[model samples]
Target chain A: MINSEHTAIMLIAVPLLGAFTTAVFGRVSSSLRNIWVLAILASTELLAVLLGVNVLEKGINVYALGASFPTLTSPEGFPVRIILEVDAMNALISLIACTITLIVVVYCLGFMRESRVLDKAYTLILLLLTGMLGLTLTGDLFNLFVFFEVVSISSAALIAFYVHRGQSLEAAFKYMVISATGALILLFAVAIIYSQYNLLSMAALAASIKYTFLDEVALVLLISAFLLKAGSVPAHMWKPDAYGEAPAPVAVMLLTSALVSLYVLFRITYTVFNPVTPTIGWTLALLGVLSIFLGVSMALIQTKLNRLIAYSAIAEIGFILLGVGSSLTQSPHTSKVGFNALSGGLFHILNDVLDLGLLFLAAGAIYYLTRENNMNRLGGLGKTHPVLGVFFLIGLLAVSGLPPFNGFASKLMIYESVYFFNPLFAIIGILGSILMAAVYVKAFYSVFLGVFPPQELGQIPKSMLAAMGVLALLILVIGLYPATVIKYLITPAADALINPGDYIGGVL
Target chain B: MALKWRYQRMLANIAYITVVVLIGLGLYAIVFKQNLIKIVMGVHIMGSGVNLFLISLGYREGGVAPIYTLAPKLEMVLPTPQALTLTSIVINLAVVALMLSFVMFIYCRYNSIDSQDRRLRG
Candidate 1:
């Protein structure tokens, strides 16, 4: 039987091999290349489902990379050789990442029906997925960084793939400049940690972060860099232009990457800086509140759909940050409030990816139907394309934290948890939810609910619907049984977050 | 504190400030400039200045180059920052080169290099 950890890893390697071959063969024929991309992504989805089944069964399974055995005394046990560590924490998240990636890949094919140079696009997509997978599974810090670079570069290249628009060039240039700066800052922090303790594994590094001024400075610097990567307010100016100008699927991919990076940031704060007495927690919480207000206020005024989504994403990030911040700062004596907030934050990450993935796909679909993504020019597409309208509705409802959806459940947890922290922030958080809902309603009314567009654009292909439908289904399932998933996946991940000693014990 | 060390600390801190001022001026030029290439050069100058600042994080009272000799000692300069500087340099080079390539692509499309003015008017 395939265990939890390497099952996901095996899933990763197959696509990596496919990506390399596709890159080699991508020059051969565009039609043949499309098949290769679809087949690989389809196979990747299969592996993710199989791996999820195993993770559900085993609770939290940690498998060594390149070797079958697991021993505490072994160097691999310390995450020395880039171990693929998967637990219930990452199992659900992994499935969502793979599922979204596959959907995006398929949607791209239909979206690029006119293009002949589509094979390079397919190769880049698979490579990006591999890097995202490696980033999710890697138990080592430097290894994670390497994978992050791989994903960042591939996605950045994907942004400029069309090369037809000056806006894309401007977006890509600003993206590279800002991203490179962040990457350098991250490397500097990693070196500081590695130099202090001759180990670069996340688990090991956390174990080694004793209370020292050096550690404090390093932690602050890392937080700054990661917030930049996470696309928080003060550091998030590039996100709107970058995401807006990129192809819609690429925009969705970048959103997932942003969530993934934030997940890493949460893991870092909980594990590396856990020992400090709650000051870091308050500081982080403040950052979250600031981002929430800024993002929402900005989103309200955006005339373009992509810019709206980008800003709203920044607002949602505030919610995640709030949950994490409250959990960190909570009195060690109170378990329920802290645990709920932390788990809620992690849950929202999964919810955000799928729901947002569908929405971006919908945006792409809308653009494909009508040449413009501007809300001003678009209206009443609902009658012409019923399926796209429903997909957009489900996505909009879920992200707005409406009832009977995954976003609602996670935001409930965040609200309840925040009630215990501060009433003002809780109110602000709800206000943010309302603002997002309002803006998206404006988005929905303008695009899907109004007057019909010109007939020249034709329908968005059925392949695109397949992708959106799958993401919608994921949101429904997670929404329906929040407790079961919370008990199984979120609990274990949050457990590891709170008692990071467990992760340290597992590795070192 | 030793007398020789006091003089060195004063001199070194002064050097840091001077370079930092030049970096600020260069960045000011980059932000306010209308030319694309000059802005890129300004960014490079600012980047190098930051790289220098990062290296200075490892500075100490009486430290030498980080290479280890046969006889082990703890008095050597902090090798960590040096390693950080090396990685930072490679990453910076990659970033700058990619930026230039994008500029070239932009030049081809627009038939001009005055990015700010063109972006504004377009």
Candidate 2:
């Protein structure tokens, strides 16, 4: 029988090994390299799922490194080495990261077939997966910072893959600057926490935190750095630039990367600073409102297709943040309300990944066919590529939070729960969703419904269609079974977040 | 307090002030500088300042190195921060290399390192 502990280690190790082997052997035969990558990713995703199920079934899974026999606590009864602590919350997110990465890897086969730097792209993708897996799985604070750097550097390289395009390199530089700065600040926060408690383990820090001035400084630093990484309003300039300039497959990967940052943001706010500080929670809400307002409003004015979707993505993040922010009110009456808000927020993470992922794939298909990203130049794709049009329609409806779609289920929860907090905020949230719908509808009209362009569009690749088809199918299934998903996946993850005692106990 | 002891306290304060000043300079450069290389340098300076602060956290008066071979029984400085600073310094190296390569790419593409002339401007 395969131990679940081994699954945790394999989830990260396999990808790192595969990345290196692919880079070395990829030069000999591209097809062989592609198959190798697919197989590696397939196993990684399976193991991630297995790990998630294990965590869900048996509570938190702690795999201690360099121990006598891989136990949680040392002989002296204190955790001293690095550990992989997989609770329901991280396990679900780790599964989401792997699942989305697998889909994008499949898409990349067709998307980057003709590009000369295929080996580098594949290698970077695998390394990117390694970084993300490590980021979500590691129990040590310093290890998290290290893995965070891995994600940022690999992603920055992937964003600038098309070096010939002047703007892409420009985008890459901006992304690197922002990420590097955020990472250093994050490291400084880690240092601060380390200095205070003389420990690097997250659970230990959480247990020992005194909420001192230094702790507050660390908290502010962490919130600001993660908020910036997740591309909230004040620091969101990098998102549209990076997402719009990256290749479609890479853009999808970047979306997941940004989601990891969001995951960390919630993890820190909830676990490290649990019982949700009223001020911090409200501060997060304020940022969420701005992101929603700016993202949807700016998306309305964008003429470019990718940039528009990117802006809409920012707005979607706002919704998730809103749900998360609502959970910060800690009164006894509001605790029930906070749980509901957190569940909605958690569910929205999955919904956003699927919906935005589908839309990006549709956008990629359109770009793949026409080599055009400007809505001004794209016209009548509905006639030439009906499959893409259908896919785009599903994405459009789902993202705008219409009923019978997964987005609607979560957003409705968000809308109701947030309403308990403030009626005006709920009203504004509804307005943002409405504006988001208009933005996507406008994009649909401009690109897919207009008069047929005289220029001929290329046929979409089968592999790309297969990728989109799978995403579209998942969206439909989740949309159909929202309650089942909520009961099984969303609630456990929320429980894990609200109660970090299990996480700390499992580690120490 | 004795004058010499007061001087020693001021000296210790100077060390902290220097770290703070270096961090301030780094942030100033990162936020206000236009040159890409200068921005990269700002990141470097900030990183160094933080690393310095980390090393300072491990300092002990008249303590020997925390090496087992040299001082198995002696009072030694806190070694964890030194270890952390080592890891951080390596990470900083990787970041600096990546940032510099990106600057090279930027120069090749736009022939300018001025952030204003870049196409990604808001």
Candidate 3:
């Protein structure tokens, strides 16, 4: 068995190594490049699983870089250098990220067959994955900022991969600008924390946090920057652009990238700030509600399929925020209710990953077939591509939180708990779900059940089919066994977040 | 207060004000400027302002550079922020390069750096 300590770095290094190797060797043979990319991603996924297993077994694993040993602190007992802390929460996210990436890599073999910059695309994908893994796992503040940049830069580059497409460049430019500005603000926040605490390690800062004016400033800056990164409503302008223009596989990766921002938002609020104010929960819920209403309402009118899905994604993020936000309240009764909301939120993250991923892949299939992203131009795909129809239906059902799907299981929990916060919150959430359902149903009818076009359609590739099949299957299984997953994965992940002292204690 | 102490305090205060003013200028440019290049420059200025804030966080009056071998008895400025400033500078440099490359791509495609270009309404 590989030593557990090495697993964290291996998770990051494997992808970084693959990125460079594919860049150099990919030009030699396309088949060779595909195999190389597949091998590294497969291994990375394995390592992620191993790390997750280790986190469950070992509680929390801390790998201090450049230290003589796996010691937590310097001779003076302060955490002085960079560290990678893998808790159940980070482990779960890393696993989700790597799994989605592996699936997307498989799907891309077929999706990206015609693209000119295949090698560059593969390299950027791996780099983005590395950035995400590091962002999820790193314990150092500065390191997180660095990895955030890595993810942003690569994602922007990937979004603009279709250079001939004019809109792609514009989307990439907006995404790049927003991401750069957010990173700068985040750095300023980091500097503020450092100036006060004289430490860069998150655990160290958490142990030393004073909740002063500077701390509040840092908190606001951190929240806004990450909220922008995650594409919340007011800050969500660039998201639809990036997602609508990026290649299908890259679009799925972009969702995970947004997820990383959400993860950071949770990490900063719960761990670093440790619920400094009671209002945090309500504030998140307000944002969540706005995102849900705006995202779904806007999604209703979009002409293009990808943009519609992108809006739905924004709404999905809002659901997660609402569920998690319910728990941030200070009332004892609400805190008890918050645990349930937290579980729902955590469970929804997984559901969102698979459901949204399946939809994007299905959209890509349609795009692959008709070469038309405009929904008005798409018609009668159901008759020609029955399996994709089923896949699309499954994705639509899951996303709209229909019964017997993973989304419903999580959404149910959210509604049940959030009702305790206020009946109106749950009511609005239900109303949003209804609107979301209507939007997707319309999209499905227009795209698949409408008039059949005379143009010849492209056949779906076996690899792409397999990728979608697996996601659909997982969605079904999770929906069926929601209790088992909640008990094992969601509960522990929520506990990890709810109990910040454990995280700080483990490192300090 | 001692003359030396007063001067040092004034210097540090000026540094703090410079940090604030620089960041304000950067934000102004970003929010008010229409040109993409100016916005990119604003991002750079904001980054520099943050870097300056970090470096100033470690500054100590009458302190030597944080080299132990050169001055063992002198009060040394904290070196951590300097190190952090270096890292932030490199990251910012990477971001600036990326922003500029994006600007080039945008210019090549749209023939203008105006943020108002409505190629994508999203």
Candidate 4:
């Protein structure tokens, strides 16, 4: 029997196995493929939850494949076997990833019966989930790059799902260009680090090259590569168009799963580049500030519901960057900033995943009734689709950081921390929140509170609604008792982040 | 030890400068080109130039070729940079292929790949 440590790796591998079997089953009946895929996700999530509980009971778990378990060196000297590591931070992230997979599966079950290539879509979805899980759990930097490419390819393919449309195709093209470029740059950075340090293990690299010129270049390059992946400021140009034109469920998935990259960005910044350069912190803060302003401004102009949601996500991401940035600063950085900021950011990460996921699903529901994403055409939906509208309202409230929602807790943590950094920056962040509130209010009024649109007086799939319900419940739960979450999960992650010694020590 | 080491450094410097100039010119073409195909070609040029520069980073004055002989005492070139350039070339090839496929898809869909034509016609 596999132990608790290996369970985390299996959670990721199971879905990749499912994706493979689903593709093979595509030769069989489509219903069989769908059923098996759903079964895989449901089982994976159940296993993940069980494993997470076990890990919480018995501290962080580590697994090494082949040669030996935990610190095995290959006889070949090449060290070819993949090593998978799971800490408390990874366990929580795994739960979140699997939960999102579960919700997305339920959502897709009834969401796309009419599409001809539903089997392919399901396979891609499973593969994407597997890639994300692998990313969050992988130990080595080279494997991280490989997992990154896998994620990118699947995401890009999903973006181009409806190839008949000009908008989707164009968006996919731009996404392809940007993502391919980002991957190459990431590969270059990885190669540079490997050549300079001669160690592929992230922990080893962290240990060796403690303070040197090569380390500086590698750290800057690593930060740049992650920032590109995270879609901060300059690299954020592709996000709006790609998310806007994607089919609604995929957009929901995008909003939810995309936080993985930011999580990775922070992980690398903290672990690999221990005591990150002050310049990098200030770069994030600067880009974050710019993104906050630009994203809100862009959101104000968008008439399309998906584009508005996409832009709002950009603004929220800026807040996360701010929190992460200010964490390392604050006049003699404390254990609190890393803990507080990442805890807030990580909590907000899940919040955005659920709240914004529900909101996008709500947008999808609206589009189902009327086959347009334009907000000008949608009105008085609450009267006709009360359940959907209410959930969306919950999402809007939660997403804009209002009271009694998950976003508020996370946002408050960051807001207080940033205030610690600079009271003026905190004020600016608050102003951004207020702008977001106004935007959502306008969104609510335009979509749900006005005279009924004849086009939207209809029904949507119950499956999608159920998915939104799951997300909405999560939003409320996380919001109400964030401290419990911090105690169990964020504290460990914060410890992991600041203490590079474990990672370095383990590798060398 | 006294064989004018300054001359080798001078050679390296010239090679580096020329590589940079080539890359810069290619980038300028990419940024300034009006035609989409030209821009694609420009990117290819820039990529190739960068790859060459990376390969040159591995070269040493009197190093033997990267082939292994049973005999010892032959200093080998830096294999890391060569490996890096090889990876870059492959990745660039993939990018170029995908980009061309996209251009074809666009042309098939809209009957033109030119941004100017599409915008003006629209």
Q: What is the lDDT of residue A223 in candidate 2?
A: 85
Scored by CA lDDT, what does every candidate get? 0.76, 0.87, 0.89, 0.74
lDDT of 1 by residue, A325-398 (tens): 88888633337888899889898888888777888888888888787878998887888888898989999999
State which candidate, 1 or 3, has the greater lDDT: 3
**Best candidate, DockQ-wise?**
2
User: For all the predictions, what are the DockQ values?
Assistant: 0.28, 0.76, 0.75, 0.24
| Residue A466 local lDDT, model 4 | 86
Model 3 gets an lDDT of 0.89
What is candidate 3's CA lDDT for residue A192?
A: 89
Model 2, position A453: C-alpha lDDT score: 78
Interface Cα root-mean-square deviation for all models: 4.0, 1.2, 1.1, 4.5
Count: clashes, candidate 1: 2
DockQ value for model 2: 0.76
TM-score of each: 0.86, 0.97, 0.97, 0.89
Error of 2 at A128 (Å): 1.2
| lDDT for residue A307 in candidate 3, whole number 0-100 | 96
Q: Chain A TM-scores, all candidates?
A: 0.92, 0.97, 0.98, 0.95
Docking class of 2: medium
Residue A57, model 4, lDDT: 78
**Per-residue lDDT for A338-421 in model 3, tens only?**
889988988999999999999999999998888889999888999999999999999999999998999999999999999998
Distance from true position, residue A70, model 4, in Å?
4.7
What range of 10 consecutive residues in model 3 chain A has the weakest lDDT sum?
A68-77
- Can you write out model 4's per-residue Cα lDDT over B1-122, one digit (the tens) per residue? 54678777777588677766776776676557656566567667766766676666677778887655563567677665676677667756766776676667777788876655542110
Residues A119-214, model 2: lDDT tens digits:
889899999999999989888888888898899999999999988887898888889889888988898898888878888878877787788898
> What clash pairs does model 3 have?
none
